[model samples]
Target: MAQNTDGGNPFAEPGELDNPFQDPAVIQHRPSPQYATLDVYNPFETREPPSAYEPPAPAPLPPPSAPSQSSRKLSPTEPKNYGSYSSQASAAAATAELLKKQEELNRKAEELDRRERELQHAALGGKATRQNNWPPLPSFCPVQPCFFQDISMEIPQEFQKTVSTMYYLWMCSTLALLLNFLACLASFCVETNNGTGFGLSILWIILFTPCSFVCWYRPMYKAFRSDSSFNFFVFFFIFFAQDVLFVLQAIGIPGWGFSGWISALVVLRTNTAVAVIMLLVALLFTGIAVLGIVMLKRIHSLYRRTGASFQKAQQEFAAGVFSNPAVRTAAANAATGAAENAFRAP
Candidate 1:
């Protein structure tokens, strides 16, 4: 009972009924993929169609699993979202690195700016460079849109005017001191028939003049040079000491070298008239000094505000302009063009 008579024929080209395993150590060899390259065939070139083999289809999904379940399969032709995930992650990391670098650069810039400001302060004797706030505003601007919007209704702060209230008042006081000295000379002339005689007090006026000039003027000049609030404060205190000395002198109080002097004796003897006049001058100076104090406070506030403004501008500039790659590229292009044009220009 044979399905075919091929077993009885040895040279029958081996019928389909033949047992391939019965061949003595011989087997049919598969067409190896090593012989394939781009579906080409030749001794030097062998290829196969790229579409010859396909990855298995995912088994028919079991009847829709519960909404909580999901599938994880890697079928050929299915996009590997991993690539997208990696790209997104790489982009995020690069952006973070860029931001960190930008922030670091901003920090360095701010530090440099602060150091420069400190150098300026030290060079100028620690005064703020900005001018005084003064000339109080009207309750409202006459025009609908005031040209000077940033300036307040309560104070004036024109950037160019360097004189503060204290400087102005000190200048006036210095002028008054000079006038008083001149008047004393005139009074001395009126008293001495020969205009050559010197009073015991003439020497005191001469001494006081230089001391007052030094006490206030030097510091005011330094304040102007530095434009600093710290210098103003120092100047105010030192000048206050000078003012106190004047008050004591005017009241004929004893003990500042002239306290027990022949000048004090003469001053006390004429205290009623001279003391009253000196007290009037002192009161006027007091009022001006109070005005200066107000201006100093206002300027200090503005100084702090300017620093804050610089910081804000730095942050916004870094975020909007410097951090943008497109902007950087454009800036680079512009710089290159400018350099090339400059070089070409004879």
Candidate 2:
């Protein structure tokens, strides 16, 4: 081998040289990481190496305030979207408020419509059907004459009992009148000619039967039915007169042949049994008279409570008179005739 001056031997096995990096003191005294706390280990202690290896600690970050201060300094230069955000929030609020108001208005409109429908229903007499048809046939059925049906509306539930009692009284009064006629017939059979008395009885039935229903009872029925002060007053006046006549007839006054008193007078001279019967019939007539007075008082009390006055009656009467088709036609004809006469005279 040739002699080399750079080092002793290049190929010889590496020898332990005095290198600074390889010194134990330099290795032991190597700089520790700035972020971690270094712990001293004892050689004598039995220690186990950690199963998982840990990485070296990284360099420490700067103080927290340093980044915050830098961000604060840069904030003024950045663009803000304040105007767009505020406008969007306000528009959303306004749209929500408008929707709420619209819903409220729709609810009010629906309520008004419902009220209008109810009012219209009430105006049509509170009946299920709009058409004022007789017998009130079903909506699906063809129109037919229901003559035997209860075509008229019933009295109000509150007043039905009271009205029914009044109707019963009217029936009693009619029955009493018919009984008087029978008594008259018996008296005539004993005293006068039977044919004449029988004819009179028939005539009385024919005349009074219809009048009983139409003149007095029907008027009173209508009074309670309509609850009209005018009709009530009219019925009271007319029925009071009729009841007075009934009383006179029952007393057997000479002109009052329809009374039980007349029958009793005719039979009292002859038959005691017939006389007793006739007297009872007379008592019935007196009872009817008393009942009429009582009913008149009751009806008057009801009328007074109605807040109706003579002025209202007068107005109603005038309206009824003027509204009459016959009266209106006659008045028109009279006016036309007067105009023609005036033209002819001139």
lDDT of residue 222 for candidate 1? 45
Stretches of candidate 1 off by over 4 Å are 1-164, 182-233, 246-346
Top-scoring candidate (TM-score):
2
**Model number with the top lDDT:** 2
Q: Model 1, range 58-94, lDDT digits (tens) per residue? A: 7886787545313566579976664567898998899
TM-score of each: 0.27, 0.52
lDDT per residue for candidate 2 within 145-184, as digits (tens), equals 3232111233444455556667778778768768877876
**lDDT, candidates in the order shown:** 0.50, 0.67
RMSD to the hidden true structure, all candidates: 27.8, 19.8
